[model samples]
Target: MHRLVLLAVDVALIVMSTLLAIVLCGPQSPLPAIANIGLYPLITIGVAIPVLWIFGLNRTVWRFTSLNDCWLVLAAAVWIVVFSIAGNFAFDGVQGIPGSLPVMQGLLILCMLVGVRAAMRLRHSVRRRGRMARALFRDERENVLLVGLNPIADLFLRCAAENAREHIHIAGILSNAERHHGRSLRSCKILGPPEAAEEVLHELSVHGIRIDRIVLAMPHAHLSRSAQEALAEIERTGAIRVDQLSAQYGLSELMFDSAARVRVAGSEPSVIAASPLSSGELPASSYLRWKRLIDATTAGIGIVCLVPLMLIIGAIVLLDVGYPLIFWQQRPGALGRPIRVLKFRTMRRARDRSGRNLTDAERVSKVGKLLRRLRLDELPQVYNVLLGHMSLVGPRPLLPVDQPSFSAARLRLRPGLTGWAQINGGRHLSAEDKAALDLWYIRNASFALDMLILLNTAKTVLFGERIDHRAIEEAWRDLRS
Candidate 1:
């Protein structure tokens, strides 16, 4: 899966480089002359993919690509140029295209291939730096999962808990030894064997508990394959970071008292603070990470799938309302940050070229009203989802004036296109009532519940909204409790 995605990205980069080489090599106004540059581009790509693959370009991980790999990249560029020209010669004797176009294209492809890898390496470096930096100043406690249970683990847990400055809560422990199952160390339960890491994570996610990071209790070289796989899976999901507790760490200074004192002078941090669900710094756990990945991927695919429908809607709006095909407004997003929400323009200008103002009914076109009824206007906000402004299911983003008083909690999660409130009572629910239901989602969020809300959304759209007074009351009761 990873290699396939890399191959696709390379192909796209090669195609883009081809176009750029043509434009830069050709005379100005390259559009009119593109017809002359015909089959050569197609022939070039046919030769390039196999040649690049043969050079083993796709085998290297972009994030870890180094100077040692540059020779291979350079060799791939040379072969692409050679075979492309040969393919063109075989196809049509290489007559019409510019003589230097292939060379230019090859060089451009080489630069882009290397440039993208460099960018990936930089992003990886930046994220690591950001985490190290955040740990220094963040007042919120981190939820930690221990990957092994041993004497080393025992000492680390004891020191962390007893240290006055340790702002960490030990969620549980995972041991490779079956003997440690159902055991307890320093009031921390051995959740299960290391192989059940994913299962343990999912169980925590249901109750809004997310492990910020996993610490290997023993040496890296001594860990078992199952322990390694568990860590890799967790890291790959981007859910939690994994670190090893070195002998030097315990010898030099514990993560708590001494380090904390050195990092911040004369300040105290909460020792073993409660779950982050209350701190507003929600852990990027299994569900939150999967939700983001799903939201972005689904929205991106949805935009591609709905492009034709969107174009049709745009045409209707243009024909009826004229210009400015999209309507955008600022709405309060996650944590009250402002974000621009986009939709197809469903209304005409308030007033025409005339001096008189128009009525609200006059502003809305019949086509617009129909779009509202069908909820097609919400389609454009999928791009918002792709952009990280919203999710597929959550609380709706409200205008500043319309937001509920308890919006701070609602905003903990990003506003969604369709939410629990939308599928439940929708517009009929009072502001406070909607807020209560949204709060319920914040506390007990899980992938299963999100899927349920999405399934019900279809029913709500087809057969108007349903009101559940009991559910609303239950939400309020949970919140108060």
Candidate 2:
């Protein structure tokens, strides 16, 4: 019902924008001649609705409309103008609609679409700020002192700020760099180096600043010796709680009781794996049921909606590369079980003189590259989701040969069409790096995290940004050490 209302509004906006453009662009009013061009206007509407739907304009949640959504609206409007112009030329030659009219119509449509969404975003922001201010005034918030001046730390700070309902006040940052001391990040000051952790806490307390939590934003693998000592000392003090932000697994508050015992030494702390999930360590049955339900519903709707596109791609692939369009490979599924995963054959079955297959770069066809770029090749994996062999969002299934490297923790979760690692670094990541990401996902799986991954995947697919694998590998190694 909500969708219907949005659709109606969209159509009305498109029509009104076109009419307004005609009036504004032409020397004389085109209202009387609108009767003559009624067929073209109807054609415009017919072309626009589907184009807008294809661009996901109707599906965009207005309250959460972002720059990406605005871009989609612009793209859809451009397509509408292009299609309308083509229709005008085809139906009534150059005498039909003015070329300038289409251009003006497209501009107006883009403005209206983006304007409405922008207004909603503005209103939401204003309300959120108001709520945050009120909550802060009421002292209904936890003052958090974040440690580290890294990207992960920045992300945490941003997330906390955006979530007004959470009422997490970031008091300041504590970094290892002496130069960064007294510096500010997003208005949160950097207190001091790791050695100053105790001093800073005491100072905040002395100033009547109640720090309810101290968040160590550095990844567990990268926790510095001084940071570790500071954490240990903080634990010993027992006045405030400490939280460790694992970039791989997500942020977790480590109470002294539950925190893994660590000795402060000159060396880096060893990366401790989470306990294996046994019969006694399973997730709640209700959560598992809900996850399965989400997977099934997403896959079912995806298959139904995308069948036509898939069929078209299949025909093209058959013509381009000859028979057998679907490529099947054995991959590690839930609990290390072998499952046959399906994808559109993106590479030609080409071999070298030595009877060995060529590299992926050599075997990949032009159409295959396009399919991969658009991520259209993975559409067949919906079948795997429906068959319970995979999930809509989880760790990407690994080849049987690659399975041995992954921890048992990763194997416990169903492999997905898209995952945290894929969105982060994709094919650029090393085996160990990917495994770490997978293990992290398994440990910190949640509905919100899954949705975030899906949203990021959509953005990645839409905008073909290559992941810097080398840089990611270096960062991962640094975090681990």
Candidate 3:
């Protein structure tokens, strides 16, 4: 009975939009000559209602229609128009129906179907409708402030609108650019810069909206000393919380637990034989100790001196693709723990709003190709070295799904920015081959081997990744032995 009623309501909507389309297409009212008007709409109605039934679209809760529902609505619209036109042609002609009427009516039906559902959602939660919504039913919604002027802020807004309306009411956005101040993103006001966050919080409180949380959307942001002092003052309030988007999403540093460290550090691998040395035992060794010191010194100096170059690359990425200057992913580190791997974004968005996947070649821009060729994309990884999630030289980290069974061999030590496998074969090597070459590096780990890998890395960048089958065969022999 409930399904029948919903179907009837949709039919009524279809009828109304069909009439509106006809009237707008013609000069006069479609009311009086309704009897004389063609059967285009009659066929449309006959085909559309069942299409709606088949799609199960009437079952969707309008107040929370999701993106999937929108796609279903789109598909139903296309099929309705195609079948309706076919039905008209089968009847010999659509008398009195203009050629363009069916197309216009189809579009109108789509808009009305999606719009009515969206309206219900807006009425259910937006902040501007807060007073009326409270009168209807009360729910605790956090007055949240978002910091960042990047694409991530926009992503968060869409997500919160679709999912967290009852629990989060975004107060406003804080941008890093002065030009964007007094502007709006997704209808939420861009209050000002992060430097003015304390001032904005005060202003918002004065206007009766108290922010309970602030989320940092950008990966990196710069602030003056006075601004940092101001933020410290806000932090002292003890009433608000600061959150990082990456931490909230559980993107990195999650693979490390006390137990995992104990297991990976002690386990003997079948592929790569290693001395029974843990992280502590290694630090006492002079060579191992110096490796960490060298990694730190090099990364600290490199980061400072490369700032201007990184900035130039950042601008190219922004103009070539869009927001999100940094791209990060979770990859395994030492002791089976994971680190948040960082790099500059090198491709366009993975998919469109409609959820259509794009090919890699299609998404790769000229700037991205150049960055990959010059190896500048790996520059951001120096920060990881500074943070000690990785070493200056070791086996490269691979995504968990892509790793082979012998991947534990690669994780025997901290992952590196460049390694034996990368310098010898890099992108040209298969996963199995990469595992073997990395095992060879593990067996022969030393200061001389590390220097050799670093020097070859320069050659690989100048030339290109070279595949050496002899190296792979030698590593495989050692593994079998």
Checking candidate 2 for backbone clashes, the offending pairs are 221-479, 222-479
Compute the lDDT of residue 287 as modeled in candidate 2.
Answer: 59
After TM-score superposition, what is the CA distance of residue 19 in candidate 1 from its true location, in Å?
Answer: 3.9
Better of 1 and 2 by TM-score: 2
Steric collisions counted per model: 0, 2, 0
lDDT string for model 3 (298-416, tens) is 98678657766987998988998898888989987886788888889899999967889989997888889989898898888987887688888988887877766545556777889
Question: RMSD per prediction, one decimal?
Answer: 19.4, 18.0, 21.5
Best by TM-score: 2
The global C-alpha lDDT for each of the candidates, from Candidate 1 onward, is 0.77, 0.75, 0.77
- Which model is ahead, 1 or 3, in terms of TM-score? 1
Summarize candidate 2's per-residue lDDT along 347-419 as a digit string, tens digits. Answer: 8778966799788899889999999898988888997897689999888887655653324556677889998
Stronger candidate by TM-score (2 vs 3): 2
Ranking by TM-score: 2, 1, 3
**Pairwise lDDT winner, candidates 2 and 3:** 3
Give Cα distance to truth, residue 281, candidate 1, Å: 5.8
Number of backbone clashes in candidate 1: 0
